[model samples]
Target: MTRNSLAARALPPAVLVQIPATSKANAHIDPGSGSFFVQMSLVGLLYAGVAIKPYWRRTKAFLTGRRSTPEADDESSDS
Candidate 1:
């Protein structure tokens, strides 16, 4: 017999398995999870922007060789 025929004969038939309805794992995220992810992403982005604003201003000042406005400086002085 040829190698191709021998290889085909060695493999068993494939069967499909069905899962029960009581499974915990989901194939797709529900709307609740989707909305939670969107809200978390927006909150994270807002905090990141707030956290990076100073660094962004400092980098801008360094590259331009000019100080930023006194509003940012005033905030630092209050601390």
Candidate 2:
């Protein structure tokens, strides 16, 4: 369509929309959730530790500044 025809059929300016304040939510916020979050985080950490347990010896060695790899440990144990 032509620009002039489009301009003639243009809609009126929109009103500024604003949300009206309403009463507070009636939902119950659990006060006991702080402990639950702490417990869940601890459990997650424990689970992570357990999941990586096969690599625990290398992990500990690496943290203690050891440069040896798991293969080296296995070779030494075979001697």
Query: Highest TM-score: which candidate?
Result: 1
TM-scores for candidates 1 onward, in order: 0.44, 0.31
* Per-residue C-alpha lDDT of model 2 across residues 1-79, encoded as one tens digit per residue: 2342233224221211123538865769764778756765654444344334436657777889877564543331111
Q: Residue by residue across 1-79, what tens digits does model 1's lDDT show?
A: 2343233234422211122347566548565878856765654444444445566777888899998774662232111
> What's the C-alpha lDDT at position 9 in model 2?
28
Q: Candidate 2 clashing pairs?
A: none
- CA deviation > 4 Å runs, candidate 1: 1-32, 72-79
> Candidate 1 at residue 30, lDDT?
67
TM-score of 1: 0.44
Q: Distance (Å) between predicted and true CA of 21, model 2?
A: 34
lDDT scores in order: 0.49, 0.45
Worst 10 residues of 1 by lDDT: 11-20
